[model samples]
Target: MRLIACIIAVCFANLLYAQTAKEIVQKADEKMRGKTMQAEMIIKTIRLTWSREMQCKTWMKGNNLAMIFIVAPAKDKGIAFLKRKKEVWNWMPALERTIKLPPSMMSQSWMGTDFTNDDLVKESSVVEDYNHTIAGDTIIQNRECYIIQMIPKPEAAVVWSKVIVCIDKKDFLELHSRFYDEDGKLINTMNSYDIKMMHDRIIPTRFEMIPADKKGQKTEMIYKNIQYNKPIDDGFFSTEKIKTLN
Candidate 1:
């Protein structure tokens, strides 16, 4: 009789603590990205054959505008990309040309990295494009998390068929995420680590992504500097600016 009573008590507690998957996702997104943000990071692409580290600065405003410019790797410097609404443009300083990226190039890898151009440009908003369901709970890095399975809504413009996200329960940090293909096969997995206070928010300072089928390939992004909700001119996210400014 005591065992039965204890089981019921535990179930009741879990029910009270559980959150809707959509709510959990929104909270996690809000924690990471606020209105306008500017950040500098280094991306290390580790391959069995070769490894390289690239540095860049990025600026983003909501879901509409984003711009990134490479600052390091002397040979690849002055390369920039700008995205606004559904449009994307790439500036090549070596060629002195600004080419508009077509929709067909969305799936191409960015800078020869595991992340695709669409992933780098972020043409879609995660919160708006997907229908989220509370799958269950799991533990990541010794922290309890809310596991959410997200599927694209009808006619939503998204590439991934499904994405599973694990968000830390206490601070709403996204600890890990898995991307699946249209056939429901896992394609890539990304993990967050080294949680620390940056600016005003506590977030993971390091992110690593690996392809499921590739054993010797991975990409790691380390946040060197970040400032959220900083004043940024809308005019700055333009092809003209990308062509001229570094």
Candidate 2:
């Protein structure tokens, strides 16, 4: 009877662990939904070996839509990018024009940053677009992580064929991701670093993207003074604001 009781307890413990991991991921996703952020970032291009610092703002509604507005360095001021559904558009200050980004260019580098254009914008939820499986448990930067593999669902429109993510075991915050192309070739790796206190929660302050083929080609995004869940007008995301914002 004692042996049977021990076995039952072990099974219960395993179930609890699985539930905890799922809750962690759900919390992280919930915190990011319907939020706006303002930041100053330094972008470095490994290919050109050049870097630039700029101020920016972003608004996101759920995982499907977001917009980033650039506000600094004079030359880049008033420029913005909008992502809605599967479409992306860029607003240029000099030309006072909006240009729609072609699907083929989604993988191109974003403004000389190490991040691809797709990386700048968030995509559909990993749970919605892919089938997630817990790969294992590991440690990343001293924090226990649940290593999860996400493969695109059969009907999902995803650029990468597969993605591996490490989520913090305690907070469910995403720590790292490895992206693979359709040919099963590893294309890029992204790391989240420098956790900071934002809105009473510890959040990653810097996100770095590095290409697998280009040595020393990397982009690092540093977010400062982030405030979440701020009140923002829908008009802020409209084309009118894109035209007049500076």
- Model 1, global lDDT: 0.88
In order, how many clashes per candidate?
Answer: 0, 0
Give TM-scores for every candidate, taking all chains together and pairing residue i with residue i.
0.90, 0.83
Q: Put down candidate 2 lDDT per residue, 151-204, tens digits, no spaces.
A: 888987667898888988776678999999999999999999998677656888
Best by TM-score: 1
Range of the 10 consecutive residues with the lowest summed lDDT in candidate 2:
31-40
**Which pairs clash in model 1?**
none
After TM-score superposition, the amount by which residue 134's alpha carbon in candidate 2 deviates from its true location, in angstroms, is 0.5
